[model samples]
Target: MKQTNYYLFDWMDFDESLSKDESLWKAYTSTEVKAVDGDIHITVPYQKQVLQEDMLADTDVPQRDYILILRAYGDSIVRMFTSMVDDEMKDTGSYMLELDKALTHKPLSVEFADNVYTIKDNDGRTRARIDITPYNTEWWSDLQPGPQPTIHLTVYPDGNLAKGVELSDDHFSPPRYDALPIGFCLTEGKPDRATVSFKCEADECFVGTGERFRKMDLSGQTFYLKNQDGQGVNNRRAYKNIPFYMSSRMYGVFYHTSDYCRLSLADHSSRSVQFRNDRATIDTFIIGGETPERILFHYRQLTGFPPMLPIWSFGIWMSRMTYFSADEVDEICDRLRAEHYPCDVIHLDTGWFRTDWLCEWKFNPERFPNPERFLKRLSDNGYKVSLWQLPYVANGAEQIEETKANKYISTPTGGWENAAGTSGASNFSTLDYAGTIDFTSEKATEWYKGLLKNLLDMGVKCIKTDFGENIHMDATYESMTPEQLNNIYSLLYQKAAYEVTKDVTGDGIVWARAAWAGCQRYPLHWGGDSESSWAGLAGSLKGGLHFGLSGFAFWSHDVPGFHSEPDFMNSVIDPKVYMRWTQFGVFSSHMRYHGSHKREPWYYPTIAEDIKKWWRLRYRLLPYIIEESRIATESGWPMIQALLMHHPEDKTVWHIDDEYYFGRKFLVCPVMNGNDRRDIYLPEGEWVNFFTGEHFEGGKWYRNVEVPLDEMPVFCRPGTEIKVYDEKVDSTDDIDWQKVKTLFIE
Candidate 1:
């Protein structure tokens, strides 16, 4: 492996033909090399390197592209290939690349055609590219050299370096290679179109690289690459981020990318996996699968997968900008329940904590007396609690002191420093999870975990894991650099809290606001702060649908608007908005009523009756939603699916972002506007209106339908079964499925 201070590059020794100079392929200065993994690290010094014109091939062939192949260690090797088309080697063409187990005796192929070159795997899958046109390099000798060889590639005006390979003679290859960093293994095999299989010991499972909807454990089951995020365990984020993962089954896959991704298992451990990216190579890996899938699955999964949320979590969640006193909170919940309005979870905004220290995690005794009893009372009434919290630690927080004393927090320079300032906006004072807690250091993770444990013991059921997405890249960590930690900060923080919650309560939930590629492993993710207009609601749904498409499963948003006027700006709570949003929320894997303003039905009495009706509708639909959640937990399918997921082949569905498919059955067309009528499109399948039992033809658009204030457009695909429950129930566990009615769409 080529080892640099920051990255580990896989290395390999290939035939002389693959190198610029046959005899000096392994020479240090001629081809500077570093061992990151088994991957060969090669850097070319600019002035010292020479390219023999004769040795350069005129690869441009019309109607065909070329693939450039380099072989490293059969497994865990990282390979990169660039192409030059035509006699004028100035313009480098598109190239394909792959890294994985090496093949025996098979030649890697590169195709050149129409002034474009294509790179493919042993099986011929295109990976990455450098597009070059003949016009741009009419005269090859016209190019000037500075310190490196000028290989012509596409250049973007936005300062993006594209379409070319930078050549330098400063090659520094390390003499001896070492194994990959922690939790990795090396294997040997060839790259071929044929499926490759490896033996995994019994109980070994796979995790990482793909967007999954369940907890970070995949043992005794198989998974494929498909992006989806819904309101369930597997559905947490709006989109999938990382295309790579390490398998606890001993090996892992890192699909090289910049495009759509896919992963399929041939069988448990005795299987072949494939990675596909738009302009990148098909990179695959194989390793010894010996440990239980649970351990490796979670290990890699935790690296990507977030934790599951708490169950009391499934209740009605009410939120608004501020709820100052415990009495106000009590009054809101009491009014909702007293008025027979369904409600469960109560959210307290930034005001619940000490005003002097904005996110101290300490309840203000003045406003909230007898915190324990107050929470117990809410719990007794079937209400669960969620408190808003960020990664930032308050300036005077006792926890900050403890964190510093234990060396569990990040230091600005060399000592304890406040990460969250009292200014209320973002502060550099926030604890950098990537830097603060030395997760690699056993002591740090333990110290941080203890703080969360105390909260779990305090009856805190859910934590809003917020603001991790905006981590500053300038911060430093004693263990990990800021850049490396920036991407995984959310994962690390969520994992730490999740671990503690699980230890104390067996299972816990975190409603994280910001995330990176693998943040989906966490149970619930909400859209970032939004406004209270129709556009905001529409944006919320679009964000949710987009996130689902990206690979997040369970997503929630503040009801109405998190920062909108309580009266909805004199527009009144448009029943169309409430009704449509409710329908969408009910079909979601998890539903909650939240916003910056009070979202309780009684708050908007004009729509209270209709809101109650929809609340009942949601309660009745719990069985179906729950079952969908279970299915999502088992399979990677999201509970809230985009229409394209159901009709992938339908070009129309691909651009239909305004609507989404709720699970496999319901098609929800939310009213993004305040208009009473909506235009809805039905894909090429018979659809039945849920409320009216009206059937609509597939593959067409319908307009001018007078939607009642109490209804949103909901269509159920023909031949699907829907389960319903009583609206009065407090918890899903007590609902009798047998007593619930099942409706057939047809």
Candidate 2:
């Protein structure tokens, strides 16, 4: 479907009204300052223009004053908050910040001299400088609103006061009509909205903001920081949106809010990066680092680190859109083992309930007559059962009336009759007028968990927490308004599922699709709904690379893509696409084969042997993958790291998005296009090809490197040792730890 510009259709897609007009925007002028507990707090009274016959008069407009707080976290990270209502800005009571327990809050010293406030760290090194002078403000004309006092934030990323870089506000004059004075402006029409603009260098690049699929460098793009049903992996719509970005200038900015916002990174204006939020406060944390990895490390410290997943989750998972009956599942498992394909999990998607996609949380007795016995049978055979469910209760679901009566569902403020706003529900064809589970209510969460607990008692090990993106904005919740709960809804929903799974199985895991900032604590998530094409494969890889940079560790995508051309039922996926996608899936942090059609390798007979080869290699490398996952959990690094993360000094590798480091050793350049050879860039290290033991020089691009269909282009450092299972195993449970052997790359 074509995207519509109708503002009322999808309000999340619309820009905030404050960015439209400059005259309605106002700034708070600094009046006084004080220090409490070594933290600097400034009081800026709100200012408005008094127009008499279209002429400005020196008159004060009495309104609430704004409080700006500046504090330090350790020596590198600084928190800045600007608000009118609260003395200190607080999170939405959301779980976005699960700060590391070892994070120390250090007191920063502030000094005022020559009309400038300098903030220094414990070592007395300058961290930031604030200027609130008349020169920092902008105006258009005599009839325009006069300049108000604006706080100009200049940050010293290197802790050198002399080398401070000033993030630009809007530079507006009469002839510069392209410029809008949106630099730190509050909307007069709606007090809840705010916009902040920062100047960007001409050649600056940025990456992150969670699971973006468009490009690796977000230099000239605009991304909406809100979760939505992307429909496919080829669009700007994202299932995971984080309001944080790492700049090419060796600094990071994390916008701390749960409200839907827009991040224009040099998109509209070539020299400005503007952030507009639907919230009243401008709260952000600026982090300084010498490398991108260090920036991500501090980011993970502010939020939470990724949890270690179970050993079996690293193995191949067999799944499709709908696995209907127990007999069909049994046949697939039998064929998988018969064909010597190593598998660990079988996910039953959207077909486990009495009606397909009904999500009643009950097994279809006709298809799965004995849920417990069936799950135990699979469990005994070394396979885990992953059940699929969502947070929405459909209209015809058996538990809908119960959920409504218990007030476990989010209802419209004007009642259910006024539930017609588009929250991207039409993407999923079978969706009905449903009630979204009110995860904000503690009672509602417990009630929802009780339903899953029944299924957990029946031996299901994993829960596929799907579809937390399509939330109605006008709906009412128990604790927060819909706007407040919009972005963080996925985090809460995934947390409930992860906690319940751990409560039963002792290994917390949820195959979640949607996410926010702190969703990494839930262990695993996947790229959503991709087309079964080469472009789909490329797009999915780009999304994963950006997601890894955005503080997530484990991520997967549908093998051979999720949706085929035209439709999933009628189109036959190309055999080469399946083979190459299988190779890519085997190298990811978690591997799963799923699509609209039957995704079993046997469907494509000619390439079935090639697909099995990749599966066996994955099992052989399971030990290495598990150890790397442990490191990823402890450190903030991702399993599939972008090339720039490992070598920030190598300027040539900044834009190379197609290749990534699988763990710390292997550089995986997937065969996105089916060809006999591809170009590979070895970044500043001695690399040995994993397949043929061919040597390559450092800091050079190898064009058209000969690669076969059954082989992936993987390179590792010389003499790098990785553990591999020396024997064939049908599943992760069958692997003998004693038989693991370390293989040297060189």
- Please report the candidate that would top lDDT against the real structure: 2
TM-score of each: 0.63, 0.92
113: Cα error in model 2, Å: 3.0
Worst 10 residues of 1 by lDDT: 177-186
lDDT of 2 by residue, 1-746 (tens): 12333211122222333244222234444566666786767676554433221212224645446677777776667777786434355533447887776767666777888887777777888877777655654555576544444556676744855434455534343212222222223334545556666777888888889999967778988787888898888888999998998887777888888888888888766777777777757888788777887888888888988889999999999999889999999999988888789999999998888888778899999999999989998999889999888888878888878887888998877786666643244355455746789999999999989988999999999999988987866678898888888889999999999999999989899998998888999979999999999889999999999999888999999998998897655598989889889888888999999888879989899988878888899999999999999998888689999998888767777688889999988899998886757888888868888888988888999898777787788888889999999788999999888888999877
What local lDDT score does residue 195 receive in model 1, on the 0 to 100 scale?
18
Candidate 1 per-residue lDDT, tens place, 1-746, comes to 23232111211112223332221111112222233322222232212111221112112311112222233222122234322121111111211121112222222334556744443334433322223343333445534422212222211111112211121112122222111100111112211111112223344334444333333233333333333222222233423345554443233443333233333332322322223222223333222122222222322322233333444465567776568878988888787777766666777766787673266667888999878888888778777777776665544565666666665655554333444323322432343232334453467778667666666678767777766643433445556655445445666677676667667777657776655555666668776554556666666666666455434557777665444444432334554566566655766666766654456676666777877777667777766776666565543456667665566445565456667777777888877666767788899968888778888899988977667666788888778789766547654434665787777777
lDDT of each: 0.49, 0.79
To one decimal, what is the Cα RMSD in angstroms of model 2 from the true structure?
4.2
For residue 246, model 2's alpha carbon misses the true position, in angstroms, by 0.5
Best by TM-score: 2
